[model samples]
Target: MSTTTPDRSYEALSYEWGQPPNGDFQIHLNNGHSVDITENLAAALRDLRHQDPSLAPRPLWADGICINQKDMEERQDQVAMMSDIYRQATRVITYMGTESDNSTGAIAAMELYCEWWNNNGASSRVEMGSFTHEETIAIQKLLSRGWKLLLMCGRRTLAHWSLLSDFVVHIFDGDLKEGGFLLLPQSSHGTDTRAECIYQLALLRHKVQGRTISEECKLSWLLCDFQVFAATQISDKVYSLMSVATDVNIPIDYARSARSVYLDAAKKILANADDFTILHHSFPSQGQYLPSWVPDWSKWHYGTEFVVRCGHLCPSGSTRPSVRVGELENKIDLKGLLVGTVTFLGTPINDHYQRSSNAGERAQWVQQELESIKAHLNGTDPSLLMAECLVGADVFLDVRQRSTIGEGFVAHMKQPEAIIDDVERSLVNSFVTAVRRRSRYSRLAVISGDYVANVPRGTMKGDWVGMMNGGKHLYVLRKTSTEGEFTYVGISYVSGLMQGEILASDSPSEGRWLTLV
Candidate 1:
């Protein structure tokens, strides 16, 4: 509420308010009166107030203090200005409050680790054997912290930083002598607010480290990361994110419904990005009224492993874009080419179950899923089928060799059974990169007379798999009761569809263009 000066600087605080546990504290105002503020903010203010005796009282902007929550208009205005407020501020302090028993040790370990990295250079894998027992324990505790776990979430590889927390949690439960790791329950402290802190802090850190972030990409990150950020009001998720979004420029409207705000944000993002990649990021929303394509940012959605976008079918500058979408009436108008119909399907490959840790069990489950798919395929040649299913099979194979699955290929095949097991493993391993992507909840759909692809859990046996004009990946389309109408069932990783199979086939009658809404 004060004017800025060149000599003066403000620091923004990003942390959880945590129920105002210490209750209220009095703050003296200019009118010689006092107002009550939460204990959390009071603590933060006290911390800042006592900070440097040499300097004047530093200006700080904490959301709980600066914005009047009772005033909706003021909240909206303040929320809209958040990006500017943070970006313009000299520093953004993330206050996790007083360190816990493990936290102090974790912080020390992090400082030492960073120092080591600075001197020794960066290595993707940490050589834990080189560290002292105390160092190992400290590192483990740090990795399991909410903020650290948030940073590791949705990562491409769960082998390093992501798995460190699990190792720490289950160190005594498993036989680490044989390189076996056990699953551990996720921390209760992994709140949406913690995720929000990680994302915002990491983003700013990226800039500090001299990484170039384009304007368009920030919106994508904001959209993806916003899903885990805590917000009291459903609409605030969108409103809070608007400031950070570069591509999506949605107006702050307190009158608008959360759905409307979300839909508007999606529209803006699509309009600016001109790709269906945004649409592919969708997961089922908790609110039934929310659009299936528009993600509900307030809730957690599993199986968000990054999709491998092979540049074959929808390669850059391919004359025809892979996806095209427009709004018609009250629904989104989508037009895409139907690659093929799913004549056969595999059982949902559940890799995330509690008992899925056993390698033999994992192999057996995969084998069963593959057998079902192959049985449905009948006598169809696997190569021809794969040719039809993938975009760049050769390229994908090359990429797989370098992936975590590929790195452990020999170990995975140690006790393999029938030929179908290897085939299924290879097929599943090719497109499915991470443990998260290989969900037991998601099934594999075999496009009739074309190729096999992976679809979300709810995909039916007869669901249609198509390629939106500018879409990066194949999409599952379910036919509605009404003729010619189809609903999008989320994006599918159809293996063979990407390598120009449509062009290779002489029979044009095999494929048809359908309008999706």
Candidate 2:
């Protein structure tokens, strides 16, 4: 009956608990008693029971059943042991909810599509003629679920699930994908771990990013990848992640505030890795009221639109970035850098709701957003701002070249007085091509003092964008007026302006660095 024997062979279920139905849903216990569970978990058990009839009443571990929900101490202990629980299991069964209206057909179509993709290669347009009427409908159903968006976007998966576990069922049965496919039933859990499906399902469509790079720590990866998942208890957000985390020594006290746990985790992660990778991955906290420096994993969207590539934003040819942490505390101090006052700020381009799925719609939004930036620039020459917009973040080839500049640019040192005509035109052409291409996933802009550049989602007009000596991307700084210090906004991938007046010339008179806390 004890699931924590450490040597027991059992199946661990990974599923989202959907909203409960009108009546009680109960699970039978060993003592000839039954306990209530979410309707979603009950549904999963029924399917599991039917799935392997041969193994009648197979030994399994379901969080809702195994952990005593009412006992805080037991819940914390079990939650901390989840990673080991999953890893030790003979199999980790992901319960995607049962088939809905057209789910069976949708799943079959997806399987066939996977087979075709495995045999052939990546193609944007699906060969609808190759499928039957039902298959077409299935594909449409899947597409309607934004499966297409999952294919195109950058995502991260649970490292343990991606690398350690072996899945039992092949929902999208086909050749092995790059990482592997994890077909989950539709549930609220999908909201947090849905990106995990991108690894399992979307691998068939596009080449998954970061498949090659070695992850430094599991906690960092979890914070970066699984920021969107929510937990009932705020502290569970940190506690539940203990299993897969390489550093488990961090305190897991349920009594402590989530902010304290997060701050402690950040401090530990920074100690292991000197680079500022975690800072960039952090998004603004969602209602948790944590410090700006602590990443609120509760939020779904990242701070910026651009994917913070590994070893990115560090100065050229440098493997290790210049970073230092507090001696015995959570505070981090960035070496002295420049600061600029907010002269002008633009309206938000992408808010929580207004994000457009269609490329054309996003381009239209970008155009309108640029027009708004133009209004704020007043009478200044629009060329520089336009060039920055053109060289927007995630522009692939352009970003690669712009991010690799080592010796700095002569034209940038003489900005306002001198401009690189050829580079400016190239950026202009890039911007025009982006608009025409109509692929507006990561291109975002914020305006300040006759300047516009690609910024993350939450970037505001008054935020200070400055250069750190070894940082590859511009560090967005927020002023703490009362404390007379600054906090990090996510790193900015402002194209073309990488070496401009904001970061260039080392003008001691023009820039000042306040202690970052």
Candidate 3:
């Protein structure tokens, strides 16, 4: 029964242990000892028992049944080995509970989509007209269920079940397609069918390129992606991912507070990783006593968009991190240059767009925002600057497209009620897409030197803009009462300075040590 036993063959169960019911269900072990279990786990066990009579009574590893949760030491030891246990198992069975809300139809639709993907190949586009209305609804349901399951189990493990092992199954009947649809679910979180389709196509392309799921399983990436996943014990947020993440080696100790665990993970990642992307992952803490530099994984910050594509914008280009832990308990010293200071602030882009009720209102708001940005321009073209700042200088949109989008904004502002031409409307659509790309927590700010930036919400006019060594983006720092120290505000996206212009002009030796609390 030891996970380290290489010769043993057993299936590992991956599932969400839902809230404990009003009463517990008992399961008698081979030793004649009855153990109380949660209703969700009991249902999973029952459904698993009914699968393939020939394969019935097979050796299985269910965390609830196998691990003694009452014993802290045993739980710690077993949790530490979870990654290897699932990886070495003959198969990983993902039980998504019994079918409900036409789950059978959903599974069938998933199979059909996978068939279409395989036939058309990842390079081909998915036309919405190809699927019927019923199929679309079913697919949406399947996507939603899969996402909920993923929120509990880390994406790397679920990716294995959906893509590699092909073991995602519902309790009643119908099998999920091998190489399952790995799309984002339709939810109130702002993702839609078009976005889901794009994500699916991207995953298919990666699969076609023969990339292994393990290749993408970095600790930093896992933490950022799964921070919103639910965990009864807050510390489990970091502990549960230890098995699949490659770059972390924190000791598993349930005795530590969640804050302590999160702080340790943050420090370890900063010290180990080559880039400072981890710094940007830290959001405003929610009543937790932790350093501003460390991410509070337990708190879910609303409208926090994943900025994976922003890696290319190296404001402090090619500069390796020169950092050291300060004498103070929670302070760290990072060497970097002061970019500028915040002077003017605009409405948070997402919030402003959300307030509008119709396309006309939305267009009017965009025009007003663009005019405000234009007024701040010292000498640079407003259209070019606004285009770059809105999208964080994303490479996905080329220079020409960005200019057209900016010009469209100007044209719209000039004639708010006039009908737009085909090309202009397409450009306007691009502008809307760019707005969605920005994080809702971000706002438009004009820093010193008349430099505009997409700064974190609540950034004050006097906060300092800094370019930390090894960081991909500029960060805002609030000066502390202590003369030499500063508290970390949040990440900022300053236009014009993102392409290593500042670092190229200044010598590395001139950089000062910024002590962050």
Candidate 4:
């Protein structure tokens, strides 16, 4: 092995769990500890306990405890015990309770699970990817220390079996757990899609973030743009989805034709069989179609708007579904507002408000700021778009109480002042930097869905299925001029293949087997 662990490993590891030298089966660990899993886990333990009544304690390495999320760190530390845990048992009781869950409630992995697990009794060394870039460097450094690569998530599925017309590795991830119990072989019910979705997502992220290959940088975005436009015209293309469970706007019989044509046109423009993203850009009205509401520039706006409205930023300052920063930062100057009248409770009195007339007028200032940029290294700076509205399921909430001023008393807007920053300044360094600063959309603000596509649904306030990583569901795919291949980011799922391809958990009477949001 090189002094540093290889950035990646290509070693071949085969499983031969039935080795009989010492006992029923054997497992070798990356840490150099050797243990036995035996032929059957439960039976073997029973036999041992039967032989010596005191010898029957269940092993932690048993599938029962191995996949618990609470024990994640210990889980990582004990990875070396896997082969041993599986090999030595004389009667490994196979649990097949919930096909989609992790180990806790899992009896058997989904059939779509990787083949590396196909062999019942085998042991071998296999190559795997580094945990991360830092891990890659660490592994390289530990190469001389004899650290071995015993596991990898994607190699056995995507990299190993690309020939299949379709393959979806499901139900191996340890989380996304639902409630369950533990019995024979230890099992719980969870989402099988978690593992593969996460696996493929992580891989997609890794590839896009890796250093760019200069030779393939020549494909001008114009070609990619046209291709994307053409893709939307194909058979089926996904629209941004609302994950709410009730009364979602499924197409009616009469509307289906128009919706299909509209959606098909979108599909043709994006049917390249690769990951693609829509622009989340917000711009002031330059075309005939004006957005429902435009931001007001009368006063500086804070990011708290999104924090409460979209839950884009949490109270602890960690970003998950949350996007904009400064939503809560207070700027108490008691500034300007749009004029609106509201009556107070039982007061029989009405008062005028000072907020902006429209919800989106705020973007005007950001656009002006972008136009003023001198193209210094990065093209544009970004700002937070804020709004607070009360929406209800199946209907818009009455703004009666919310909009009312206290007993005919006008409350001037004392909201926080907006602080300007480069796109790089957002909490997640991974986002905004490239999408907002490096690409074609550098000069735009985060626009609403209605503004982006000129669709009428903008007024509809459906629950959004946002990301936890501060990443927007917008992924942009750009082809390298050299290799003619594409590089993308910010998209929902990266591939045409998704968890729904393998198994669907929903009842067929409800809707489509798989939904793309």
Candidate 5:
């Protein structure tokens, strides 16, 4: 059914009313599509009303007014149901208000009102600041639920621009669709600031234009600094926002003042993005020498994996800032690294039945090879060779276990009737974990190559990566799990190190050392 309000006509089929505040209010459309809406918000619908145009119109659910927060039972019931509120609203209308319902003060005004769920329970609510895993999960959950925000442009909305990616659906100029961030003081009463406002306005302009930005919230600086810190995404409306700012119907001249500042920011980001700045250096011996660096850049089995920070300076005075980092494949041919390959091995492990060798033969052969490799490592006089070789081992592991490069959100939903799925995953993770723990032992059989990709959760950042070499060592570099870490186990030849594999299978191949008769 198509529901029309006084201002807009929206088509709706069937949507559920969740428990209240933070429950899941899912909408199942007539066409068999759906999305989630939140059940709680910072503001009520006192002035935010809509008319139903359809013959059979569905009711609008608003938490502040609809649930009667004054009623203890109702407030308790509805307040904790934020998941359902945003899930239920076909489209969210963010009435540009001064502050959030729960928090007091100016900065609190910019909060997306809800009963925030803190993973560590450090606090029930948190203002968006740096990149956090919980924040990433929260935003990703919002995206999965399909909530289009209708941001109302008022004079005091001093929140930063980074939050705009998830908060602002479509901005209203209070007249047109060109509305942007409200300007504030260098130090506004609430958590408000002009730097955040300027930064966000610049970001929305770029994103809507289909351009990508690596970072957000830049402080005003020299032209050269601006050139080196440009954002990645571009907005279609940058030109339009600039052109229409001075129109009497919708005056935004102050925004015009920010143009030179933003352009300079954009230029700077683009320049830096083009050139990779070295954060920490490897001993040169530790890095893998790809084809380009080949013959000239010496090669072994593996090279040092480089680490770089992806960020731009927060335009001066901006209290909040963010950047997204991801691993990009380098364009290079083969080097010290061998391309390890995998397919669903028919015999995942050498069976107790049809053995690749005699019943006890598999165990005996693998143990002997482990001793040989251990001896080689012990003989090495320098740490450089060990580091390089260890790095090489990591390269082998990464290339071999390419299938385990999990896309996180893939397994989020519940499989209602499926009983063994989680158990299976647990078993797999445990096995993988075991291989990782025992990797450091020189005497251990290295069946699979292993490495840990530490993504500083919430930010798709290349911020800190702790790579373990020599078949699955966690290394001393990393400390916490909150940093969004995933351990890897690369399936390799078991004869040399079956300790690395809980499972393995192979066809007789001539090279890389096994001489099978």
Candidate 6:
């Protein structure tokens, strides 16, 4: 083994370890020791070796090859140092496996787009229709590449793919003349602008570049964003992010169980976060081992579209969290007031409805769901309430848009035929986007006091809805067998209680401690 100085120049590799190839892909060291590596790593090594003729024998740092994965202590130490390793490297070479899925075309298309963008003064006037058919096809391929890479690595590592990252952010940040244009292929439901994912990437880049974000907020956001990424070992979900997240300090010990690592990470985040934003990421875990309060990063959850705090909806309202660690493992006590119990659950807005090509069918499904929720409220017209709940209380849209959309929703409910007009069409599009943002992996619920909520799918009729002190979103808690104890169902978006209405009447002192397991 050789030791290198801090000033030494080396290239750090960021890649997905795809499935192993058919043959045993092995490399021999100078000491004559053969080490097996994944097919993706082997491809990356070959690409790095021949990228430049004169840069032969370039010093490289690849996690699979350099880190002693078999040794728990060494793995932990190496992982802790990964952040500095990537930051100090001459450049980060991100290899997204061998170029399949028309990746070459995607790269070419990106170059073309960048060239066009630079020539056009980065104007919002440049629409997707301006591109030729061939160019559009290439752009679609490029977007597919972006989504694949994003799902594989998450946003933090996307910055390494400089060209694609910059291009996507530029498009996302551009102020279009009208509504934004679609960059990806047109969905059967018409051209739905898949800008949400791009917007997230752009937002992350902006925050990181601004350097004004707190370490706590940064770590919390990073953890939320990283939940979608896949990893061979579930613990790596937390450990892999150790390099990018400056605030989190959980030990990267593979010797620990996945649940243990997840629990420790959750505890650390909750303790340090400025608000209860981390709780928004928690969902019902399929496994019994993980506590309901802790997030299971291994399993994918869909309601994250509404997780971002917008500084408006403060259910807990200026109260700091009163959290105490329980004497028993996998248990915590939090002080908060119960908003109400869920009295009715509307049909879940499944993925099919969200991805449906028939706009009429999708709209009808949403309308029926809303009508069902309204029926439960004793024929009380919940037009605005339903609108607010569906779109997450205007968190994503501006005040004017929210008003217009809310009015459109009322009109749509009154006369479904009028939606064919241009204005109404635009309204339907906005409504669809809003529903997609909040409703995926969730269902509409009617709580006590006739309040409506956008709750996680698993929320039952009897689940208790409460707001943790300093939390932006209300949480759904299920009663446990033990008295005065509950298990977390998930976060919820309640219409009336979202704006601190409960806090206005009930003081923080009135809140009681509820144990969560």
lDDT of candidate 5 vs native?
A: 0.27
CA RMSD, predictions in order: 7.1, 9.6, 6.3, 25.6, 23.6, 4.6
lDDT of 2 by residue, 1-517 (tens): 6766766578887776667434488977678998779987887777766455576668879988888777878877787777778768887776656565465665545555555655675443343355566654543344334332221111122223222111212222223332122233334332213333444343322332444436433676666655545565767666777765765457667888777787788777765654555676665544556556667765555222234552323322232344466673546655545444344444443331121234344445545655666666674444444444433433433545555222121122232334448675344334443332222223345445445565544556577766664455666777776464677666665544454434354542333334566
Worst 10 residues of 2 by lDDT: 148-157
TM-scores of the candidates are 0.74, 0.66, 0.82, 0.17, 0.20, 0.84
lDDT of 4: 0.23
Q: What's the TM for model 1?
A: 0.74
Query: For candidate 3, lDDT tens digit of each residue in 9-52?
Result: 89888777887634569888789888888887787777666446
lDDT tens digits, residue span 388-503, model 5 = 22122333234433233221112211132435465455433332322222221112221123211121112121122221112121211111253333222222222222132211
Q: What is the lDDT of candidate 2?
A: 0.52
lDDT of 1 by residue, 1-517 (tens): 4525667678877655666434358678788976567765666566557445998767788888777777889988888888788888986765544444454555445445444644665333344454556655654444445442222121111223323333332232222322222112234322122222333445444453463465344565566654545666878777777766665677888888887877777656655565666566666434626555666666655424233334454521232442235655224555456666778776655442233345567556655655666776785545334322322234334454434333333344344344445565654444443333333246666777746676777788788877655566677888888776777777776664564554454333233445554
Candidate 6 Cα errors over 4 Å, as ranges: 1-4, 20-23, 51-56, 117-199, 212-218, 243-248, 307-311, 350-357, 362-371, 411-421
For model 5, give the 10-residue run with minimal summed lDDT: 508-517
Native-referenced Cα lDDT, model 1: 0.54
Question: Which of candidates 1 and 5 reaches a greater TM-score?
Answer: 1
lDDT by residue (1-517, candidate 6, tens digit) is 2325756688878787778544579778998897788887887777656545776578888888898767879888887887788778887766665555545655666666666777886444566555566655655655654343341221122323456555665654543333234455554433433444545555566667777545443566777776666787888888878777778777677778988888888777776667776677776655638888887878755446454445477878778888887567788888898888989888776453454445556567667776888788999987788778877866877777876867656544433444367777667667766677667668888999899888888998889998888787888999999997999887789988887788787766678998888
Q: Of the pair 1 and 6, which is ahead by lDDT?
A: 6
Q: lDDT of each prediction vs. the true structure?
A: 0.54, 0.52, 0.68, 0.23, 0.27, 0.70
Model 3 ranges off by over 4 Å? 5-7, 51-56, 113-140, 146-188, 191-218, 244-247, 285-287, 300-305, 352-357, 378-381, 398-423
Question: Which regions in candidate 2 have their CA more than 4 angstroms from the true location?
Answer: 2-8, 20-23, 50-56, 117-215, 302-307, 310-312, 315-332, 346-395, 398-452, 456-462, 494-513
For model 4 the TM-score comes to 0.17
Model 4, position 144, has a per-residue lDDT of 16
lDDT of 2 at 12: 81
Off by over 4 Å in 5: 1-60, 70-72, 79-86, 94-517
RMSD of 3: 6.3
